[model samples]
Target: MAIGLSREQAPPQAVEHEPVRRRRRPVLVAVIVIAVVLVALFVGWIGIRAVLARQQLEAAQPSASAVVAAMRSGDVAGAKSAAESLSAHAAQAASLTGDPIWRLGEGIPLVGPNLAAVRVVASATDSVAREVVTPLVGVSATIDPRSLKPTDGRIDLARLAAAQPVVAKAQTAFHAAAAGVAGVSTASLIEPVGTAVDRLDSLFAQSSPVIDALGNSTKLLPGMLGQNGPRNILVVAQNPAELRATGGLIGSVALIHADHGALTLQAQEAGTSIGPWPTAVSDIPDATVGIYGPLVGRYLQDANYTPDFPMAATTIAAMWERAHGGTVDSVLTTDPVVLSALLKATGPVALSSGDTITSANAVPLLLSDVYARYPASSQQDAFFSSAAAAIFTKLAAGHLDSGKLLTAFSAAGTSERLRIWSAHADEQKVLATTTLAGALPVSTPQAAGIGVYLNDATGSKMDYYLGASVSAGAEVCRFDFRPTSLVRVTLTNRAPANAGTALPKYVTGGGTYGVPPGEILTRVVVYGPAGGLLAGTQLGSDPVRIVSGTDRARPVAVVPVQLKPGESKTVTVQFLNARQVGPGLNVATTPLPPNAGSTPDVGARTTVARIAHVCDSRVK
Candidate 1:
């Protein structure tokens, strides 16, 4: 019995325990094998989900581009089709990302926020496709461009009235989508997640304003266009050749009347009609008078020395009120390029002078060549009046494709070349929010508001051959000396040395204005942001004389640059008090108003670089 027990019970209990432990090992092994299989499958499923989501997103992007293109071209039906396709593809993408695998990814440590961000953005895009883009398609179809056309010298107010609600509803829906997009948070996300969010950010930024403008147009149209009775509007043509703050000198003016949409050009006048304000406008700011000199009060048209178009418009209205007893509903201001833009849709227009104004040659003929072609001021003035009257008559007669004309108007308005002001307070309130309002930009908070302005000091129209460029950047090369704001403005005189002899005396201001022929004398006025100080100014390697003073509490520095023929020199302006440069660096320049003379060999460029968190830089 003992031997049998030793063999059977274990070589007693020890033997029994050994086999039991062996069985336990196999059970543990089987559990581990099952776990390994599950882990591999789970990892593979997550990887596959990510790849599939990326693929679908890639497919949806092209469709999105098509939708944007169609929408911009006013192809409502095409946009709708494109948007629907985008919605379907985007929905599929969202569904794929909505799977359990992606939900699990949201629990991952480092990549969790990024994964969630992708889903949120995808969903938002899908929502926009449904709520904003789709509705706008119908709105476009509802509002017929031809309805705005005048018949029997009158507009069909009933058509515009019918379309107003459609536009208003679309506006509301677009604003909601913009709000939704604005509400998305991608704070913790990094790299491509942040980049992806930014991709569509500007789309909402631009579309919201456009839709709001369109919506306001629906409301303002009937009243301003005289759907009820009769309305009179003043149109001012600004000549950018002299380079005023807003655009150029006020060279021409016209009075347009719209009675029940029957548009007519009542009278065309030169800038001379309004003459001067008679006395200084009591409301004129001290800084404006100081910068523009006596001209601000001398002539009504010269009051646009401030970059604020509203200020100019208000001054114009008050001055005009003195001459004409009646009040105007609004004032529309446009530059030479605006005329060219309109002509693009209208084809060539024949002026009363028997001169044809084509889009291709409008700028040269009207702005520069006009002076060369007609030396006498009287002849030039007459020709301008005729051109203005001719355009008004043709447009009212519906001689152009209405859609293209609308698009051209849109182009002009967005480019800041076309501006409007309303006498009606309620209408102005709505317009103030849109880009068309033309109000002086509010001072950007914290950051320095450096402004560089150009004024012709030559007492002649010699700015035509002048090229100027301004740039602001951090000069990191000399980092040890407390980082300063480096602003460089370059001006070139491309005229020939004998230009005065070769060009007509009238074109050269008859040598009556100061300076040799072809020489460009410019007063470069550089204003430091509030709290910012001017450190120094340089002409190439040599320092230029800088006269400093206060402009509306902001520091102003004026530098005189007189360039001989074929001379190119750069003016470097340094600013000291840059406590809060902000995270963004602004280098601003406007292409010198499309060059007062030629089509330009080079264009004006404004460079903006964001170099926040740089070592040894003060960016608050």
Candidate 2:
């Protein structure tokens, strides 16, 4: 109590003795706070790095082998599930880096193995997932799914993005080229160039979105690495046409390959494998032959034999063998046109002994036999006609035969009676006929009887005969004749004694004539020498009679006559008759009793006198 009086000494003694007790609460609390903060910061940094790394890895993945395998194995649903899980994990990791709540978790020690596994799994999963989703994205990717190979999986986001601009540029160039092509006319040399341009345009239009996405993903690559890096990518075009069209857009990076006999291609980058390249160029327009070969072969097979589809299998086989030096079976699978062409070349082959030729090599044997038996000309014509007919039939039928007929024709050679058989065959086939006027006897006399006979009437049953009297008393005349339902007769008077003869008495004998007398007599028409119709009172009255010294002899005239069924008689008429005038000679006859005019009567005599006078004038 009095320590203040004794000040220093008393106070120091009491202070030490009172309590050696010390509180550790404050220090402990401060230590705990510092430890927590350090842990949080470290955790945050690690998490952020991991998330970023994971994102980078994910973006880099592009290989589709896993996805393809999954799909092939019918694990589509599983693949999708895996993809979703990976996406979620990536998203979670991304959040930990930027968000304060994830700070504690960030400091958690990550085993190197676990981290590497995550990255590997993420990359693999992404590659597969992307492939699975690519088709759903539509046709917007510069890379074709079909052309993609498993090794392409190694392509990182940066490379993919880099390729996008090239693809875009290529697309733009293609469109420009296409525009240039479009400006050209079909006849222009540049017209063919347009086909490539059009294809590129289509590809670019479809792949724009995918290319852009790829580019965006690639853009993120620089951030993923500690330092900027350069990457190289390989682009291969299986088709030369495609390469020519799109190569410019890809700059120097594009590899060009021509799909010829053995699907040849060149790679820009030495590391790329030729095996993955498409065996054929499917995207090019001219590549249709390659793309549709199988389809065409099928069509040929189904084609009708009557129409000769698929031509001949043996013929095709032979051609294939000749072209590629392969056996028939091998050629059939690789090139069906061989069979078709062969069949066509061989014509039709039929076995005289069996349903089919029984030779070890039926097609070749039959072809040899036909060649030996028939002349080249006959074979060619028969084969060609039969082939043509078969094609026509198939076209009309709207379907095809398996080319059995074509094959038969090809093997048989044109010498086979294929044409004859075809004429009677009920199967669909084309029928064609050509008619030419018959030859006339050189000695045939003017005003004499003449007839036309058809040489080949295989399909036709009836006979058609045409008759005409020669002008100027000529013994023969030429004419143009064709098959028809009607018969025509032409008469000309060239007798010096009957220059102005009245219409002659047309006598129909032998066979019952089907012409009416009025029609037979009324159709005579006359023309002046200058090829003008005769005028004045004569007009048509004496169409058959020509007045001598009247602006030269009458010009050639045409007369058309008709006959009634079962009628035969001689029609007597006078030239310049009052009833026959200027385009007024059309007439019909009334049925009369037979033999009524067997003898001459007063009227008949008068008619004859008038005709004689007309004849006399021309004779003078």
Candidate 3:
């Protein structure tokens, strides 16, 4: 036993313990190898799921785009297919993102909230794809928009009444899905994931409202289109040549009566046919009266002198009532641009003057060259009346493409080129929520919208040659600073250099009213951010007199700028909107004629060069 206890030769029990130690090494190595393999497997699994999620998400984008295009084009079948594909992709992404590895990773401290947010967003995408867009697409497919158009020249109110439930259901689904998505927070999300969250938020915000509006419109359209007794609406064709706040002086007017699915175009007359109102004009601001004077209260055609459509509509209704001895249900105003849009579907309309107007030349013919072609206002009025009647006849006969025409009409309203006002409380309720209502947007200390209202000081059709645009840039958007904007409006007169002699006398206003031969006198009214101040104003380096006032509680500046043949002038105004509010600076301008001889120029923009990091820098 003593000999066995030596260093080389230990006792039997000690030798047995050494062998046990050796066995422990092998066991430890085995456990370490297993742990390494397990760790490697888990990491690789996470990598695989992440890559799958990314691929699914990336693939979902174009499918979403296809759905949007289909929605716009009224291609319901395409929308459904694309939405289904998107739903599949979203489901796959959600599955990959929700796998065990990612679930465990979601509990890690720094990345936990982000991963959870990713899950929430993925779930929202799946819901929106499956629940929100698909149902709407189904409704769109069921409702033949062409059926909504009057086939016998009358709106089928029964058809509209029947489709109401479909639209309503779609609306409800959209809002529910949108609300669920809105409940999710993406504030802590990271990188591309955060971007997706933002996009989905925007899509819901946008898509839901549109469907909501559609539902609301459909709810009221049937009754308004004459489900109840017959409805009479005064249709006014405004002339962009004699630019007024809304468009131009009423070039023509027609009494249109609708019953069931039938449309009757009654007596048609030119602006000259409308007499002065029997009652005194109401709601005329002192500023408008200051410039337009007694003329503002006299003529029904001049009702649009004020930029407010509701006020003008009331005055127009009053005038129509006074002249015809009864009030109308509504007043519908459209310009050459809208006419051009209509022509695209109705085909070429031949005028009694032996001239044919297609969509390509309607704007130019109505606004510009008509003066050159015809000297007398009576002749011009006759041409307009003929064009209108032709379109009415074609639409009444259902000879044109109804879907294309309806879409064009919709596009016009969305562009704010088509404005309608209803005297009926129910119809007004429907219109209030749409741009078609043409109500000036309300601006607050936090959010402000811009208005560019123009009036013809020339008493001529010179506005046809006028090109106008506006650009807005923030003076400072720094932290803790009150955000201000500097807006620049440029007016260009593209009248021929020899406008006085080379152009026809009628085209240049025929030197009537003793005005300058080629000068375009424009009364430029700039409406700044609703609650913002008019910091200052300048016209081409010269200080112009700025007359400040409020239109329906919104601030406005009336500054007049004149341009001669081939002349361009720029006007600059500074304003302060909500300190850190949205939409930056919303600019609303009068829509230009879409079918001019050359490009009809009118646009709005936001610039960064004038964006000041500090609060005090100028936008120059």
Candidate 4:
């Protein structure tokens, strides 16, 4: 067997064969180990891919479901939150699927599956955005959702549906991607879930109907018309006449409507007459006229005319004469239209001067004619006719007859007594005739010649008739008379043989005579200390002399004067017993100057006194 063993020959030892067997055994063991390792690796990869696929599928399904549910429930915020979570997971999953590790199998195992899941998440987000966001945007743009009508809601729904195509496409892609990912093994599933969640969040961000509604409602119209508001109107008128007419029209108009709201009429005559005309006409019948008195009076006072009588005559006589020739009677008789025209032109008539005409001595004759001609029934008619009769009677009398004059005087006297008695009853308590006896000092200068005189500061000349028993020779040392707010007196001295002998200066006694300081004296007249006139003055020099010894004569040259300083003298003033006068003076009062004292006594008579003066030389 050992003959010439060539290089390719066979071995002959069993030991060598054993070595080869041993080597074979080791090689086989190594192969088995490799096979096991490969098996394990395959199983692990498959398991990972399966798990990822399941996870991606699970994540996609739920996120999509959640968005759908949120949308259905109208919970845009919840839907968005869920969608964002899902999208984040989807993104993570997509990233993992695209990793080099996932590509080791050419992305066959996990990439497609994971991408599919991501697509699903994205699609869900898109769906949510379309379903909720678009409508929300529309509502925000158009109207506040809270205020939107049901119709608006329907409109918004339609808009949302119109936007659904994009979302549907996105959903389709997501489903396709998710199916792809499920078909293959993917490395990650979180990415698609994350994408869906993010999209959903975005959609929800746009769903702000409530907020939009609130914002829209904050505008002007709703707030003003709604609960809180002010109710007011500003009305104006043109002229006083128009205002009055408008007012009357309005008042009359109200009687027409039964259910009209509260109505008020006012007149503003300051500007023009046309301003209120339109409003008056519109308001109608319920308005009042704000015209002047003369106009109003023309329409109201009665009109009766006779040759000897005129009834309720106003400046009507003057107005009539001015308009036509002759007296009111002739015109009225000649043309009735003239009276009608006068009445129409003037509006309403009032009697302002009847008292004066009634006092004339011819009143009886005038009244007789009116009483005979016009038979009046009503009070107004009677008043008119009686007044007319009085006028006619006076005219017929030719002049003021004694009977008529006496009657007029009696009426006038009665009226005056009533007025004076009412006014002075209270003041009469303190004033007395004896109070006028004094050598009061005057603070202002007086006129010359009359040493001292009682003056009517009202600019009215008063007659002071002297009484009996006052002697011409007697010196008036002191004088007393009734006190009034109108009279003031001053003292002076007669000129001596020397041309420049200064007049006597008067001074007031600092006694409580009840008269206010600076008050002008009125009514009371004073002479010398005794009941006698001042002597040494001839009748020519002193035309106004106090009569004595039972003769009645008004003291002449006794005029009122303002007092001058240091012109103090004593004189006796007496109140003459004479026939009572007729209607007391109706002199108008003048306001005291600003610098006048605030003392009660000072201002008391100022209200009724016709005369007032401010001794402040500082004023021009």
lDDT of each: 0.69, 0.26, 0.73, 0.28
Evaluate residue 323 in candidate 4 and report its C-alpha lDDT on the 0 to 100 scale: 33
The sequence of per-residue lDDT tens digits that candidate 3 reaches over residues 1-620 is: 34435656754552457888988999999999999999788778776877787788788889999988987687778888998899899889888878777788778886776776677777777666676666666666445566666666766678567767867776776677667667767777677767877777788887764676578767777766677778888988888777888878788888888777578898788878878765455656665566445566668767787777887887787777777776588888887777777777888877667888877777777777778778787887887888888878887777777767866767777677678889898788778777777667556555567777788777787787888776666644545456676667788887778787777676667668566778788888877666566777889987788677766545677888888888999887777664336535566666653323752312112121323322444422
Worst lDDT run of 10 residues, candidate 3, spans 599-608
For 487-593, candidate 2 gives per-residue lDDT tens digits of 12232211122211221222111112433222222232222222222222122233433222111222222233332323222212222221111211211111110
Q: Give model 3's TM-score versus the native structure.
A: 0.81
lDDT of 4 by residue, 1-620 (tens): 56787667857654557778978998999999999997678556644754674475457557756755775455667766766665555544444444444444444554444444444434443333344333433333233222222231111233333333433344344344334323432235455444544444443334332222222223211222111222111111111000111110000100000011111221111111112221211111111122011222232111110001112122223333333334221111101111122222222233333433221222221212222343332332345334333333332233323223222222322211101100122222211111111111111111111112222221110101111111111111222321111122323322122211221111111112432222222221322221212222222233233322211122222322232222323223322212212112221111111111111111121232223321211111
**All models, RMSD in angstroms:** 6.1, 37.2, 6.6, 41.9
Query: Order of candidates by TM-score, top first?
Result: 3, 1, 4, 2
Model 4 residue 180 CA deviation in Å: 6.6
Models 1 onward score TM values of: 0.80, 0.18, 0.81, 0.19
lDDT of 4 at 261: 16
- Candidate 1 C-alpha lDDT tens digits along 460-482: 55666777777675433233333
Candidate order by lDDT, highest to lowest? 3, 1, 4, 2
Give the better candidate number (2 or 3) by lDDT.
3
Winner on lDDT (1 vs 2): 1
TM-score of 4: 0.19
The TM-score between candidate 2 and the true structure equals 0.18
TM-score of 1: 0.80
Task: Report the error of model 2 at residue 171, Å.
Answer: 19
Error of 4 at 149 (Å): 8.0
Indicate which candidate wins on TM-score.
Answer: 3
